[model samples]
Target chain A: MDRVTGHGADRSSGRRPVLTAARVAGLVGAAAYAGLLASTRPFTVEADVVTAVALVAAASAVVVRLAGDRSVPDGIGWRPYLPWLVMAAAVVAWELACFFGGARPSHPTLSSIYDIVARSEAAKAAVVLAWVGLGWALVRT
Target chain B: MTWRSVTFVVWTVLGLATLVVVALAMAGRGRIARPSALLFPVSTHPVVRVLVVLGWMWVGWHFFAR
Candidate 1:
């Protein structure tokens, strides 16, 4: 017996069947932007400029989503999401504790660890690309 | 272990826990809610969806910008 569960019943999986020309072009453009941002030094004006561009992209996703159907969804229940809420709360709590306790080398915040890992140009570019990709996903969702 | 080491360990554990949840969800485990299930309804609310993306923006700035 086949059981069809979850949303989008017509679709077997959420993934796109084929990458369109527009998507390929977008990926190429994002990669170029990531490389350009990777070359900039952190804490410099150049890095700030790159960050601003990324933020704008994220903001654009918000605009695009809002421009669509504005109807309130049915049954936005908290029960199903309790586990995720708890996990998010735990992470936030620990981050706050570490932050207030002093972000020493031994007691590093997540961002502090990210800073160390993102020091490499390749890693930095990858992170920027990931952030851009996440924004793109947000737009699509 | 020192308090600092403990802090680092706790953070690592939290990160790992998140990864585990994502992996389980992706594997289509019946016990776990998929990422789409967790986030799709979030996009339904106009205000909440905007706030979520704004939070994402803040994280990028915090890590990558001055």
Candidate 2:
């Protein structure tokens, strides 16, 4: 059954359907990240890994769900996910490189050298949580 | 009681009280799709609503933990 709104399309009125759970979830995720762009807070290295899990979960909801939309925002299916996934990867790598490069020069506790290592490990754990959450979203009563 | 003891008890009661109030508020709403009622039926939502409210609590805790 279509998960968006339980009721399928009505044949008579023919209005465009509302967003599905996946689509709305995806849209909301994108919007949330888009909002993050305006944040003035200094970016820390841990953010990348945390966002990776969040990014995947959000993107997956949009891509997999979006109900019948082959594409949205004028981009065809799966296209929108590419940039986010790539950006997340690049951020992770960037953080790692920065951490390794700065480890020698920075304060032991204040710098991101420690953050990079911590983030990567934490990101792994977050991925597990995302998986569980996604599965719960799927199986939720 | 020590300040630590009092503090713990107060916060615990506050947390549980919050939960109870939310539950009561939810119950007062006849059902989802009923905006006529004062209380919004949050439990009927697709789990995300509950999670979102809990997320707000988490944010509150995260910010207030210090």
Candidate 3:
């Protein structure tokens, strides 16, 4: 007998997908990170660091899960969505930091390290390429 | 060595290690695609998650928010 799974997989096994506590925690954490980023403005340095760490940790969790390790508790297979979540979190953080954190008038924010590099065309290109690489890696399932 | 020097050296080593890993991943020349099994404990442990989140908040408060 074939059993249809939410993943659209037909398997003979009768096991149904279950949502574990860990999975719920990860999803909630990702969502909270996104919400915080969206509503917060001129984030403090603390906010920047927390958001960065969360983004990195979530990304790592997703990577570990996708690399075929059963370590991360499966929850609706949310690992695939992690990269997008990370990217969104990062973009929001960056924009908020840049716009609100930047010094009054023309000075860039202290966290705007990219602005320093952007002064050099080659460095700017490198940074842009790095962002592209990051996007590519994150989007890969 | 001075504390600053020590910090510089440590950062340099870490930077080089990161570059090497990135290079390997790009080249598709190694089996480093998957994180080592050692990460399992950190990833799966509940206490660790709480501690990490707490630590993150602490760092943000102390260092970022003046």
- Global CA lDDT computed for model 2: 0.38
Docking class of 2: incorrect
lDDT minimum window of 10 residues, candidate 1 chain B: B25-34
Model 2 chain B TM at: 0.43
Identify the leading candidate in terms of DockQ.
1
Off by over 4 Å in 1: A1-16, B27-31
Tens digit of per-residue lDDT, candidate 2, span A75-100 = 12333233333444654554454445
CA-based DockQ, model 2:
0.02
- What class would a CAPRI assessor give candidate 3's docking? incorrect
Sort every candidate by lDDT, greatest first.
Answer: 1, 3, 2
- Order candidates by DockQ, high to low: 1, 3, 2
- List TM-score per model, in order: 0.83, 0.25, 0.28
Question: How far off is residue A29 in model 1, in Å?
Answer: 1.6
lDDT of every predicted structure (CA atoms): 0.74, 0.38, 0.42
lDDT per residue, candidate 1, A104-133, as tens digits? Answer: 676777778788878898998998898888
Q: Which stretches of candidate 2 lie over 4 Å from their true place?
A: A1-44, A47-49, A52-141, B29-66
Error of 3 at A126 (Å): 16
lDDT of 3 by residue, A83-110 (tens): 3344446555544644564343332332
